[model samples]
Target: NLLHEPVTIASVLSVPTVKENLEYVIHSSASDRLKIDGIGFIGARKVHLYFDPPLVKEVAYEDMSAYPLTENQIILRRRHGYTWRELLGPLKVIGVDTGAGAVKVNGEDGVVVAQVMANINVALSTANTQLANNNKSHSAPAPGASVPAGVGGAGSDFLNDLAEKKKTV
Candidate 1:
């Protein structure tokens, strides 16, 4: 079963794209008849898959109807009120440059490509830093402490006072 299998960070980083990583996970695991509840790509490299219980014998790649493989890429099924067609437009395209170890997303503006593992690491680090900062800012303050003033606070206070006066009149 995937839950029992050892999927290290290094193993996850080796795959170039989210799709490929997910495929690798499904292929490598002992369980054959697995149902994927959900999947997500965090940063660029991290691929998360949610599965239901009662693991059954292994199912072949062809037998998995949900994942349809094409010559170049795997077209994901639309789910959770979000479709790849809607987000990436009708011509949703992702290209993998194996030589460069990069994955490119074709966008309206231009194609964006980055070194897969390295880019994901950087993005994850940045996200961690931002989260840390947010947590620190939201930590409980000392007793009798006043909340720090933020941008537009005075303007909002003035508007609220004006509304209160109007209500009184």
Candidate 2:
């Protein structure tokens, strides 16, 4: 589920990661695989997120119609909460040759490529502004495993505010 927000940092925690052998996870049904600690995106692109403590638990059948994973991939899942800084430790577009600036091919100026990257950086740096906070309520109707550790840092503050907002009559 594309939680009105993105989850980062939690993957870097000291907890060990659990990996899924592709041989075991591939399935004819899309939703069925989602039950097994899978991370999904639009168009049924399924990715395997690291399970905390390096353990893969057998999950019950869930209405994972929400997440449609296409190809199988792996990523470190969030194990703990995070701060604004940690959420965006250091954003960089890899493969950029700093010495030569943007990359170009076959006698083409890299103006367009550079511009696109600049815009992406802007969107990321001010992500809160660029993306709408569709988080209408404190309770995330998201279908999946609950965060291993409760939110902390700035995220904790925001979640607390949302909880308060939810409590207000």
Candidate 3:
């Protein structure tokens, strides 16, 4: 089961802009992973996310999809870092290490559902939470605090909805 294994960031791509030519690089952790779509490396950067150092995330899942056979989505349970309350969901699953190969149960087998999340949605949701917290915390952010996307007044309604959904989870 994926939940049995430790899921951590494998690689991070700093995409300064969409126009920038991105070179394909395979992250070592899931280098041998396989899928019907194609090799994982081509879209590797898009899948992996970057988190600040020392900030470990807590993972949570809402439901499992039976047909596709995976968890509905990854939920951020808690944040671990210097200023965590300011952060949103701790879990953001990038890629599954299918290359690691699966262990078999000699006697019987059971279905295992894995969690999944899109790179954009997870990021926007987290940013939405961060922005909301920023409003409550220090009236003025520390000098040069990096501004995440959706900074224009609490982001879009979808973002607000995402923030609300996160709270319920």
Task: Note each model's CA RMSD in angstroms.
Answer: 19.5, 21.9, 19.1
Q: For candidate 2, which ten residues in a row score worst on lDDT?
A: 109-118
Best by lDDT: 1
Kindly state the number of residue pairs that clash in model 3.
3
Candidate 1 structure quality by residue, lDDT tens digits, 1-169 = 7577776665232233323222222112222332322122222322222111111112212223322222223222322332122122112124332232545433222222111122244446557744865632232223433434463344444344444555566
> Which sections of candidate 1 miss by over 4 Å?
1-73, 85-89, 97-100, 105-169
Q: What C-alpha lDDT values do all the predictions have? A: 0.30, 0.28, 0.29
User: lDDT of model 3 at residue 89?
Assistant: 23
Clashes (N, CA, C under 3 Å) per candidate: 3, 7, 3
lDDT tens digits, residue span 1-169, model 3:
7597788866442222111112222221122221112132232322211222122422211112123223212222222222321333221122232223222211132111121223354456557756877733212223434334666454444444545555566
Q: TM-scores, in order shown? A: 0.18, 0.16, 0.17
Candidate number achieving the greatest TM-score relative to the actual structure: 1
Cα-based lDDT at residue 78, candidate 3:
28
Candidate 2 contains a number of clashing pairs equal to 7
Residue 27 shift from truth in candidate 2, angstroms: 14
Model 1 pairs in collision: 32-57, 32-58, 32-59
lDDT of 2 at 39: 21
